[model samples]
Target: MRIVVARCQVDYAGRLTAHLPMATRVIMVKADGSVLVHSDGGSYKPLNWMSPPCTLREGATDDGQVEWTVTSTASGKGPGDTLRILLEEVHSDSRHELGVDPGLQKDGVEKHLQALLADHPATLADGLTLVRREFPTAIGPVDLMCRDAAGASVAVEIKRRGEIDGVEQLTRYLELLNRDPALTRLGPVRGIFAAQEIKPQARVLATDRGIACAVVDYDALRGIDDVEDRLF
Candidate 1:
């Protein structure tokens, strides 16, 4: 799946709601040969050609880069079935920028991480089930958190394309979880820092701590015909 932010404009409120700014336009394309438009509001509006609403699994934005995932809602399609997208857009904030919301970038990352856990439950090697999740920790919520069968817990921190400082953040979560009794019982607690690419430090830290870390390239998760078709 691909999310293309065609154009963006600032929305400002005036005396009443009548002076609202124009809604930005974004084009989202899927690998299953489908497309949709994520406007300022409303559902994932399907592109005229596709004739269906693909389930949005994840989204993210950072430094004007936008990315997201969508899946066919059709039955028999597993959660692993999804499409990933990335696009660059101009940012001006002058009501003339052709870009997507930076918030969407973070959203995309969280969604992708969730999809991974949902799609590859076996990879978790048992004793794990996803619970609550959020992103941009400074904004008040951490990226991903799950409970293990042993009553232990795990937290996953996500990093986008250019955010190279994920190791430190992940380490903090691991440390915090290890110290918190509610989460410690899940000990030998571990953290998973997922991204399109792994920084050297992140790789080294995970290896040293014996934490389970993974890097998922967008290209690698695409073009699965059986997965796409089954999703719909």
Candidate 2:
């Protein structure tokens, strides 16, 4: 990963136009050919990012200032999106070699939920059995990969709160999983987006994409429901 702190301006062109005036900010160029622009203060989310598959070309502007242009590589009838960063002064520029990460394992709620669901795949659907937890993929690890009664592959994504972004993430996984010939032989891999609470918008999108949504009961999955009822 390459991290550069510089006084730079950013402009994005494609479906819409966005501009960030010159300021000191942190820029990250990941190994996967993605770029992210972040400010000193704000939420964890980057102010702007270009997801791969994309290309980053570093060159000089007409005035001899450093400039980096990132363009999407997606093939389509229309033109691809582009992000341009014009550097004025670089404060600190360094690159680090980060090896393969083991992937995130959130503690408390999220991790517990994954563990419980792995043991009780049927809670998500009838006749669903676990194939692997944290299944590896080219992009990243999927939370769960299971099989239905018909032996078809099912990719499951778990979140504490289901939202539109989560649905979109699951859609990407399904797209890649369905492309595998081994999994396709049984049937096209489907998806199930599971969470404790699902937003209305997310549910709608999942339905439109033909992906199933499962609202899990954390207490029930932990076997607490069998305990005698008690007032808090």
Candidate 3:
């Protein structure tokens, strides 16, 4: 991972246009070729980022100032999406070798949800049956892998509360899963973002990516909401 602290201006061009005026901020170039721009605030979320499967090139502007161009590799009809970062002054630049992450350890609720969903895959979708739990992938393990009635592979990601980052994570898994011929034998691998509550923005992003979102009911799945057990 390469981290750079600089006074820079950022501009993005693609499906939309955005600009970040000159300011001191942190720019991160991940090992997977993703680039992220972050300020001191915004909690953990980066102000702007390019996901992996992209490329970044370091160059100089016409005036000889340092600049970096990050482009998406998924271009189809038109030019690929591009993020241009113009650096005015570099405060610090360094790289580090962070070994492979162990990945998130699901909390009790999320862990239980995965187990419940695995037993009741039909709740997510009719005729969905569990294939394996913690299906291995190059990056990490998928929460649950299932197959639909039509024999299509489905990768389900379980989250306590769904957010944009969760959706992005599932998107990456889907991308990697689809590449496996065994998983894509019937058709392209599908993705399901399952959580007790899914944020509006997360749902929108999942939909835009052709992934399905499922809102799971914890109580219902646990049988607490069962009519026979309820005392009205």
Task: Give the alpha carbon lDDT tens digit for every residue of 28-146 in model 2.
Answer: 99999889999988989888888888989999998899999999987761365999999999999999999999997765377789999999999899999999999989988899999
**Cα error of candidate 2 at position 35, Å:** 36
Query: How much lDDT does each candidate structure score?
Result: 0.54, 0.92, 0.93
CA shift of 185, model 3, Å: 0.8
Model 3, span 174-207: residue lDDT tens? 9999999999999999999999999999999999
In terms of lDDT, which candidate is strongest?
3
Candidate 1: tens digits of C-alpha lDDT, residues 56-102: 54456655455545455656655444444443353332223345545
What TM-score, computed on C-alpha atoms, does each candidate reach? Answer: 0.41, 0.52, 0.52
Q: What does the lDDT read for residue 160 in candidate 3? A: 92
Candidates ranked by lDDT: 3, 2, 1
For lDDT, candidate 1 versus 2, the one ahead is 2
Poorly placed runs, candidate 2 (over 4 Å): 1-108, 227-232
Clashing pairs in 3: none
Over all chains combined, what TM-score does candidate 3 have?
0.52
Off by over 4 Å in 1: 1-127, 135-140, 162-164, 186-188, 217-232
